[model samples]
Target: MKLKVVLRKAYDYVRYDLKEIAFPSSLPDPPHIKKRRKLTWEERYLVLKEASRLYAASWVRDIGPDLRPNDYKKYDDGEEKPNEVNGATKEKEPSTLEDLAIAARGGMETLKPALQRVYMTRASAYRDALKSFIEGYKEGVQQVMEKKENSGTQGEEDSPKKST
Candidate 1:
């Protein structure tokens, strides 16, 4: 009696599988994915500002701490005199992103190469993180499918038999 029940269930499963294989178009359409909203100008600026600060901090760390602007003294009568610009001194070491930007005086051209390298490194890291996340998601879906199949088989076995 148990063997008959098992055979009947197996046949039913095979028939269902065959039907699905023959009628692939019967499958429902995938869920619609919402489009991501674009970032506003303020949001873009904030993101850029934060990235610049982080990059600056990392660059400062890699290079030594001595990021102070050079101060050359001018001699009028062979006597050394401290260089001054409108009664202001340029002796402060760059300890903040704004200060670093000011100290760079050479403008964007000078920092282009370093910025490109940093961007490439960050992009690679982001790709790796995204790949790992996708792999994990696939594994989770496979596990859920396996669980559903097992539960479905168990339910068939546990249910009371119907009399004709």
Candidate 2:
């Protein structure tokens, strides 16, 4: 009903509904407010790397514990074992995407849930980029091999043999 109340209501509406508030005309820059800036190329790369590690760690955690490598334990008999019941150790589990996730989380002790979500959002795109890079590299290697094979055989055949 009063001007102050009306002004407060308008400010709330702009802050909440519109998700932004115009600075007062008198101040060119708001005091004590941090300016938001876009991440530079290097910063983005580091963020993506961190996010990927966290995301992978989450996946590794989700996979059943059985697939994860267990630490070797020594028994009273002075024998080491991976499984509890027998002294025999299991053959290493085959590596999977889950393994990659575990490796990515290798150094990190804890994951922040909010940051993990951001990483998860970027993970798919990063994965696609990596896949493309791998494919390109493979193609380049294959082409080099093909050229070597062709050139080696052709050069030998084209050369005149010296009679002994």
Candidate 3:
């Protein structure tokens, strides 16, 4: 719900910006797919592992851009057999789904009010922006519902959100 609203607001802003754009683009276009620094196997594994952990933690499944920055490790020893020591002596506490869920809920509860205040205190512009965003979202949803009602399919299985 929240991300959908955010994206719709972004789309609205883009359309508004395009309409208000001053000097038009004049530069020549660049290549379609710019090259990026290549990742090693260790980096790839770390990324996949972190994403898996985050997906498990998300109650509403709206984890935004990496809230934590990561560094790349150049090399990694290949996978090891279970219960075998390969010179790494540290042990980590194993967490289950229940533990992760509880932790995620705790994190959200602690962060929600602070996040609200962050928007509220930025400036008058930010305050009004947030209000307008919420109002616009409500109007859009109402219009969608009305259209759905007229179409005769109040499909509970259908939500307007785009799934990745």
Scored by lDDT, the top model is: 1
All candidates' lDDT scores? Answer: 0.72, 0.70, 0.68
| Residue-by-residue lDDT tens digits, candidate 1, 1-164 | 69999999889878897777787656555689666799999999999998887678766533323333343433587653543233443466544455446546767875665566657878999999999999999999999999999999999999999999
State which candidate, 1 or 3, has the greater TM-score.
1
- Candidate 3 differs from the real structure by a C-alpha RMSD in angstroms, to one decimal, of 30.7
* Candidate 1 wrongly placed segments (more than 4 Å): 1-107
Candidate number with greatest TM-score = 1
lDDT of 2 at 25: 39
Instruction: Give a tens-digit lDDT track for model 2, residues 113-144.
Output: 43475578689879999999999999999999
Residue 64 error for model 1, in Å? 19
Could you tell me every candidate's TM-score relative to the true structure? 0.36, 0.30, 0.20
As for candidate 1, its clashing pairs are none
CA RMSD per model (angstroms): 28.4, 22.4, 30.7
- By summed lDDT, the worst window of 10 consecutive residues in model 1 runs over 61-70
The regions of model 3 sitting more than 4 angstroms off are: 1-122, 153-164
Cα displacement (angstroms), candidate 1, residue 76, comes to 58
